[model samples]
Target: MYQDEIIQRVNNAAEIENSNEMLIIRKIEESEKPMELMLNENDRISDIKIRKLVDCIVGRKIIAEKVLLIRDHFVSLHDYLDLLNSGCLFDDEYDALFATFGNFEISCIL
Candidate 1:
């Protein structure tokens, strides 16, 4: 799926010498497994298809910004994924990342 494409790109970006590329790579690496786990169809809520819903809610820019944040931070991908799953989309450093992609209206109202 698209996450696989993102993983491949992350692996590739990790090999580069540039700082930005490395940052991107780190983000992808951190996110890969957690994102995969969250996307598991069996694990998703009955009313929500996690992956599809996320794709729709986040859009491309937010997704990109999140990856960038993941790249810069040393946290595991699951942590962020959990936060997203739990509806803490604007918590802690995630808020910074969200801000970077411009102000977005989270589809799920708090």
Candidate 2:
């Protein structure tokens, strides 16, 4: 019974880790979606996606510009992975450090 319980605990931990990994990947894809739309649409981005991007960048001033660079009124996806790893991706403090990257503002919407 003791060994069975130990095995179960280990399995549960592994499952949790795997779930977190998948969650991070999904969030990365979700946050990058706005920029992805822009790339395929000749630099034209969806307003909704831009809002999503903004939600992902708030309070992450350090990495904001690194993940996204805006110049001459054009926005480009920089280190996209940075956006994925930012704590801003998660709204809960318990899950904050479970992931990792930005500061950004919505100036010119294109």
Candidate 3:
């Protein structure tokens, strides 16, 4: 069921004209499980899959630009991920993060 949900999200994201948005949605889908578990103090966002996704986004200039624009503040992708993984963000901060990653529309599902 979870896999199906992810696939649906991927398809929806693919409908967007912006390839970066599509990629961001796919990353969010990839990291959804870890992100949910990350709310627990015992779980960490340093999980390999999440890290690799972050790295991929950071490595791509165009995607990184889109991410930075969504951030609305200058910060490297590594820093953004670190802040997110730290689990200390306020509601608005988390919202901004989701918006930056093109996941705002489906954030409730996340």
Candidate 4:
């Protein structure tokens, strides 16, 4: 799954950087509003996978520490997925552009 792949890549990068912390992704059925809370009062919440939760605590820490490489990687992955879901992958122009970076293959069984 794309989510698992993203989590693995982020965790691998974190491990290489000697950061033992890892983020967790959760799915909520229904909620009035998305919120982020620490698992415990003493423990810091690295990332919260709630919808529409702006002002991520961990994201701020990453930026504040100036870890540009990891940040860029995550941003790029997010943008690529967004574009792909928006049907940009089917467009010849975008397909060629993405191909220049790497081969992106999508196979479907219909």
> Which is the leading candidate under TM-score?
3
For model 3, residues 2-97, the per-residue Cα lDDT tens digits are: 767888778777776457543333344554433321122334445564556555544545543534543443234444546456444445545544
Worst 10 residues of 3 by lDDT: 33-42
Structural similarity to truth (TM-score) of each candidate: 0.19, 0.22, 0.23, 0.22
Using lDDT as the measure, the top candidate is 3
**Tens-digit lDDT track of model 2 for 1-110:** 36666667767877777654421112244543242222122454455665566464564554434234322222334322234344444445313322222112222121
RMSD of each: 16.6, 15.3, 16.4, 19.9
Model 2 accuracy (lDDT, Cα): 0.39
Per-residue alpha-carbon lDDT of model 1 for 28-48, expressed as tens digits? 453233322112233323234
Where's the lowest-lDDT run of ten residues in candidate 2? 101-110
Query: Runs in model 2 with CA error above 4 Å?
Result: 1-41, 59-110
Candidate 3 deviant stretches above 4 angstroms: 1-72, 103-110
lDDT of 4 by residue, 26-105 (tens): 66455333332112233322334211122232233333232232223223333334334533123344433332232122
